[model samples]
Target: MATLLHIDSSVFPHGASASRPVTDAFRRTWEEQHPQGTVIYRDLATDPVPHLTADAHLAGFSDPATHTPEQAAAFAARVALIEELEGADAVLIGAPMYNYSIPSTLKAWLDNVILAGRTFMAEDSKIKGTPVTIVASRGGSYAPGTPREDYEYVQTYLRAVLADTLGLDVDFIVPELTMAPQNPAMTELVPLYEASRERALEDATTKAKELTERLAA
Candidate 1:
């Protein structure tokens, strides 16, 4: 049976969050394709993972036998998070843009899982080539040719870490201009937002089914 690691870092709930509904769509489709498959879920907003501490950072580079009690405890927590990523066949993340970047909760999760000589900087990493789909929702458009394109750090930063560094096969479903409906000044962009959102939902469903089929093959 396939295992999916589904993570949602949106501060808002399903109805209010731009990224959560799209991720939920993808997960629902994946579940339909694999009725008995396992899903490991994390809601980072409510139960955020610990930030990388000095002990945790040092533990990754030091020998296990040399770890002090503090390092041992911190590294154990880090290992549990890393093991979750290594064990998953696929990963889905709801990464809503906050201040033109990813949520700090998501960053904290990455810091814990991205260990040197293990998930990163390793030739034969367990998570290498694992499929990962990121739903990157933003309040305003920062796509190519947009005025704020250069400010789009969420995807750029995540790609650097999740794909380039970790060797995961990364794909993205972006829903842009999310504040159009709520913000009076951006009322003109509401139609565009709707279109983008619809497209994201379709992409999520299609990608989910495609990944399931690929995994079965």
Candidate 2:
């Protein structure tokens, strides 16, 4: 049976977070498409992983047999994280932009999982073809030519780390102006927000099903 690594990093809970519902939509459709598929769910907001540490960094490169108790423990956690990635048929990430970048929780998860030799090689990434869908939610519009385009660092950083470094081809389903309806100053953007939100939902459903077929094929 297929397995999906489902990760939510939004500090905002469901219903309040745009990324949350889009990821949920994908998960719901994915489950329907693969009734027997396994979901390795991780809520980074609720249970955040510790940021990368010196001990963990050293442990990542040390030989397992020579590791001290501390190194062994850290290495073991890293291994487990990598194992989850290795066992997944696809990955779904709820990556909401915070101050023009991904949440610290998601970044921490990446730091923990992006190990050397295990998930990648010196020249190429091991999981080069794995399907990764990122639901990228932003409070402001950042499409090309937009005033904040240069400030849109979430997708660019994620792509570099996931696709360039880890060899995963990532696709993004973006929902822009997520805070428009709530922000009085954003009243003019409500229409754009609504349109983008609707498109994001539809895309999530389509992409989730498409990923299943891609993985199985």
Candidate 3:
């Protein structure tokens, strides 16, 4: 069976937020499609990962065989986080746009997971890659190429970090404008938001099924 990791960073569970509900919907559909697949969940809101500290930084840069006791411990913790990602066939990230960026807890988790020579590598003066999906929740509409697109720093930052730093092929789905005031634009966005959510769930489920089937084969 394929292994899928579900990572949620939403502070709010279901109130005016697309992160939790949208991810939950995708997870449900995925499970239905792949009954034999295994799913593991990590709730960053309830149990946040530790941020990168000086000790971790030192250990990360040190040679594994020459690491000190403290550095070894730090390295072990970071290795555990990387192992989680390495073992998974697919990953689902549920994140809400906070101040036009990702939550600090989720950022910390990413720091722990994206380790040098683990999730990424600098070989032949270039980096290799992985794949990731981000289900994002936004309070305001910020479609790409639109006038307000510049306001979408969250998606932009995420795409850069996953693709550039960790060498991950990142896919994003934002169910936008969940808290906007009633207006003509808002009315137009309502159906758009619903359609986006539906497509996001379908895409996630399809990817999960494909991964599982490929692994089985």
User: Highest TM-score, which number?
Assistant: 1
**Pairs clashing in candidate 2?**
none
Considering lDDT, where higher is better, how would the candidates rank from best to worst?
1, 2, 3
Worst 10 residues of 2 by lDDT: 119-128
- Residue by residue across 9-110, what tens digits does model 2's lDDT show? 999999688899999999999999989879999999999887888778899887778788888887778778888888888999999999989999999889
lDDT per residue as tens, model 3, 1-217 = 6667889999876664568877887678778766887888899988888888877878887788888887888778888877777777667899788888899999998887776665667552122344466888787777877777888888888887788777766777677776544456577667776777677667766765665565467
lDDT of 3: 0.75
In terms of lDDT, the poorest run of 10 residues in model 1 is 115-124
lDDT of 1 by residue, 1-217 (tens): 9999999999999989999999999999999998999999999999999999999999999999999999999999999999999999999999999998999999999999998899988888999999999999999999999999999999999999999999999999999999999999999999999999999999999999999989989
Report lDDT (CA) for all predictions. Answer: 0.97, 0.90, 0.75
Best candidate according to lDDT: 1
Give per-candidate clash totals: 0, 0, 0
Question: What is the Cα-based TM-score of model 1?
Answer: 0.99
Question: What's the true lDDT of residue 123 in model 1?
Answer: 84
Candidate 2 displacement at residue 209 in angstroms:
1.4
